[model samples]
Target: MAVIKAEAYGHGMLRVAESLAPRVDALAVSCLDEAAALREAGHHQPILALQGFKDERDLRAASQLDVAVTVHEDSQLRLLAATRLHRPVRVWLKLDTGMGRLGFAPSRAAELVAALTSDPNVTAVPGLMTHLACADAPERPENAAQLARFEAATRHLPGERSLANSAAILALPDAHADWVRPGIMLYGGSPLADQSAAGLGLRPVMTLSTRLIAIHALAPGEAVGYGATWRSERPTRVGVAAIGYADGYPRHAPNGTPVLVRGQRVPLIGRVSMDMITLDLTDLETVQVGDVVTLWGEGLPVDEVAAAARTISYDLLCRVHDRVQVVTG
Candidate 1:
């Protein structure tokens, strides 16, 4: 399943879903609203609500929409028991398995399984699933420990199983089980610190770009942007891009983070502001106003910018602003 939550990681859910619907077996969203949007857009693939559900209304809507729900807590289970749906619903019972987030304790797996098995509102056997906490760092012992617990907990249970996210899908084949949920991987973002998306054979789905609107020639000591964070070291040339923090370009990205200009690499030279960012164009030849600048994607990897900003690729991908126009290829 392709994880299309957070507006398909801010690549635009409906657009990405439309592009991917014919290719994937199913799609996963963080909530019912996203799934509903896909259904309303005429997507026919099965949809899974990864965050489970909200209330009785959401539950009923999910059932009528034929969307699967991930039931992780006793409260959600109770809600399922109390609400009468027009038709049987599909479910994935989440196990804690050491994530320390959602999911019931592994010890209670059998009880939940029995409840789900006995509920007339449920259809077929509930699929077994759990999330990996740190599959990206393959050296970490946590991944192995979680897998062992998940295997032991579900040993006697009979149902399809799933335990891999993007990281696990690449690093751990044993946890593939019956279903594999690929999120960041689908967008071509590297989940591991030591790996690159190109090395993993993934293609970027989104490329954020804009054009330079201004150019400045400054002598040494001339400063750039807010707080005068960067000072020209020579007879420096600077290019200002129309893109900024307001467009989901992270403000936390420090001076010297890379930006691609005219297909050549240059360094971002100042603090990112609400409506603009400054790039040190001293090395690029004759960069001009209206020249295209790429923030991330294609020649410039989102992971590289994310690393310079002290964040993960997921954060950058998930926070793209709604004002920006996005279109499918």
Candidate 2:
């Protein structure tokens, strides 16, 4: 399963899904709405709803569309049992294992399995599933404990089991059960903290690129942008790129954040504003306005930008605004 939720982690749902549909066995989204959108866009492949239905209406839609939902709560099962639909729905029984966020208690798995199997409204043998909370940190004992719990709970269960997220798929080979769900890994983002995308044999699927719109030659002691947070230490040629927080660039990305200007790396020297960022192009003498600048793709890693912004690649990728144009190569 390729996790395409959060607009395929902000890479664009329809775009990614259209390209990946034939290649992937299934595409998973955050909710029924995303799946619906994909279906409306003519993507007829299997789509798994990670959080499942919010109500019977959603349940009804899932039944009609044959969208698979993750049933993690007792209420969800009850909702499924109560919902009247023309066809049985496909479902994944989420085991809590060690992740406190979702899934039934391990002790409650047998009960859920029994109830779900007995219910005629849902598939008798649903896929068994679990989410890894610390798969990115391979050294964490949580991964082992959770895997053990999942294995112990589902040993007797009769269904396909899927427990590997991108991290588990890359790092914990043992955790790759019947199906592996690759999310960040599909977009060339590193699931391991100690690894780079290229190091892991992953390439960025989406490259965010923009152009510089203006330039400024600042004298020593001259400050730039909101709050005058940073001043020129010496003679500086500050160039403003036509991208900013409103463009889904981090507003809090501190000075010295790396941005590629004309394939030359330069330090971001001011607060990222609503529609622009100041770059100290002092090192490059031949650059000018209208030059292309890569915010976090191509030459620079989104993770590096996120680290400087005190955030993560996931946040940066998903937070991209809807107005930005996306073209998949």
Clashing pairs in 1: none
| Each prediction's number of clashing residue pairs | 0, 0
In candidate 2, which residue pairs clash? none
lDDT of 2 by residue, 1-329 (tens): 89999988998888888889889999999999988999899988888999999899899999988899999887887788787888998889998988899888888777788888889998778889999999999889999999999989988978899999999999999999889999999988898988888899888777888998988799999999999999988999999888888889999899898999988899998888998889999989799889999998887888888888898899999999988987756
Residue range 169-223, candidate 1, lDDT tens digits? 9998888999999999999899776999999998888899999999988999999
Which 10 residues in a row give candidate 1 its minimum summed lDDT?
320-329
Root-mean-square deviation of candidate 1: 1.1
Q: Against the correct fold, how does model 1 do in TM-score? A: 0.98
Error of 1 at 191 (Å): 1.4
Cα error, residue 22 of model 2, in Å, equals 1.4
lDDT of 1 at 252: 93
Give the alpha-carbon lDDT of every model.
0.90, 0.89
